[model samples]
Target: MNKPIVAIVGRPNVGKSTLFNALAGQMISIVKDTPGVTRDRIYADIDWLNHQFTLIDTGGIEPDSSDIILSQMREQAQIAIDTADVIIFMTDVKQGLIDADAKVADMLRRSRKPVILVVNKVDNYNKMMADVFEFYNLGIGEPIAISAAQRSGLGDMLDKVTEHFASLKLEAEDDDRPRIAIVGKPNVGKSSIINKLTGESRVIVSNIAGTTRDAIDTDVKWNGREYVFIDTAGLRRKSKVKEEIEKYSIIRTVTAVERADVVVIVIDAIEGVTEQDAKIAGIAHENGKGVIIAVNKWDAIEKNDKTVYEYSNKVRQILSFMPYAEIMFISALTGQRLYKLFDMIDFVIENHSMRVETGILNEIMAEAVAMQQPPSDKGKRLKLFYITQVAVKPPTFVIFVNDKELMHFSYTRYIENKIREAFGFKGTPLRFIIRERKEK
Candidate 1:
């Protein structure tokens, strides 16, 4: 089911971006004290309880006849309000509800969408309670007091927001198919690889940078299995992206990576791995997405097996931490080794989404512990009682042990390697959690 959209709108410098950052659980938007720092509609997935919604932090809405920049900002806010299922009409509690906020409130009231009045900058509950209540006169609804900077009262506000979108289901029921995002720097043949896998030119193959502005979604059926592929815009460094469109494109790419179950980082074989390539790979690894690096334009490289080996070694050196990630040498233009790329992707996706049974996990853990017991801390040996797969889509496991702190990083790595070796989870990263065995 599609997640409902929630838009945050307020007058200039009313902590819209701050509140957005708090709710998004990340600093996606650039939050400055200056108004209009958020010129574009920034989106992030907000997880509240079991409910998920798309939260959009739009530029402050100014009067219709304001300056060009403010007018553009107002236009963007209106666009967000129009697209939103729930509108958060944010006002400044410290500023005591200005005239411009009233004007914006009038517009939101006319919008007739579910509106939740948010009184921001309420650092003191007792002092700001009256100020928050004054917003009720705007005739939208009861105001929820919050301090966006301190991230206080956001829980109650989010609870109300999710209430509006209660009809929409948040999570996917079917867990078989994995969502893969094809991401890379500009001109690295991302579109070409996506086209080859899907067997259609769904995305326009262009040599130009920033050709794909928005993230495009497409489904591919390979080996009698379905996979969702998201083709995102070529992400450039923030300093290099001068245009507003390019900046937003990078934001969209990051959001795509966060949502994806796996990410295919494409690199140009001729150019070799650049710093930007490493940055993209780092984002995938940080997000715990199953990553597969594809070296495109392999046919154009002027060398034989030795060249491929040397280049692959260099790439591996850069991404040494992600040992589970598989690297493939493919020519997106000539389709050389392109078929193997999809096969590898499927293998990684399957491994990332695998769920190990508790009995099997405990058996593997027992064997692993017997092989090399965890090191002692002050003669207190770590006793691992059991292990269970807590989640899939990266295959997170929790190991119940006697001394969680005594399980050193090296010992934990040993258990992880043992599980991988026993389970054969190739081309996928695994997360291990060591917890103390509680006495009943």
Candidate 2:
């Protein structure tokens, strides 16, 4: 299901990152005391009492900073506010409601979207309680006070935030198509592949780089299964991109990858793999998205049978950690080996969407632990008692152990490797949670 989006917006250094970390349940954004530390929008999936939503931590909106960078940051935040289903108007109790805050509040009020006013840095009730009342005059709504740095009052604030999303209709229940995104650097033939898959000129194809400026979404059905394809704009280095539109396009591309079930990274067969390609693959791997490396323009490459094999091996060497991702060589212009692309995509999507029964999960866990016992930490044997699939659509599992602290990172990787070997969940990222088992 597509989760509702919540954007956090306020003037410079009002604890937006602190509030973002609290809501995302992780430190995805860098929290610094300096203003404008968060230059781009950081997005994460937030699960609040079983209801999930996408949270966007936007750069602070500074109205007076005529500096180019500050102006760009404000523009990015405005883009997020426009795209969000609900906006969290954050303010600082320490600053005591400045002129910039009022200007931003006016912008949010004109947006007409549900705005949840949050007054951050309220550590002492007596000292900060008076500042919250001043925010009410912003004309948004009742202000919810929170101390993001101390991690207090977030639960109540989230309860109010989710209330705004109560009206969003659930995504269509019966449709089970896996959402796949085609992402890569510029001039990598992303549009050509999408055109071939959809059998139409759905996207403009040009030899020029940075031709597509937004992530375009379309649906296609193959073999009685539906797949939503998102063709994203080519991502360039931060130095190369100077315009505001290109900057937002890059943000949208990253967000699209986070929301996708599988990410198909296209590479130029002639150019081979580059650092930017590795970076894009890393983003997919970190976000737990299924990855596929597509080597486009293969028909143009002067090659023998060994050429394809050698290049594929080089790609695997560069992306060693993501060995599970399948690599394919195809010419998007000539439709060479294009049918195979669909079959491979379908197989990966199935693996990505696979759900293991609880009993089966436990059985696999028992056998895996017995075959290769976890290393002893200080002479204490790690005992894994139970395993459960907490969620699907990439399949996250929680394992209850005797000592959660005793579970080493190497051993966790071992268990993940074993599960993949047994279940054949190729082209999918698996998440494991280690929890301590309570004494009986």
Off by over 4 Å in 2: 22-41, 47-51, 60-74, 91-112, 119-139, 142-156, 205-211, 233-250, 270-276, 355-373, 383-391, 396-402, 435-440
lDDT of 1 by residue, 142-208 (tens): 8999899999899899888888786544346665466788888777899888888888888876676
lDDT by residue (tens digit), candidate 2, 259-284: 58789999999898876677567667
Worst 10 residues of 1 by lDDT: 30-39
Clashes of each: 0, 0
Query: Each prediction's Cα RMSD?
Result: 6.5, 5.3
TM-score of each: 0.74, 0.77
lDDT of 2: 0.76
For candidate 2, what's the RMSD? 5.3
Alpha-carbon deviation at 373 in model 2, angstroms: 4.7
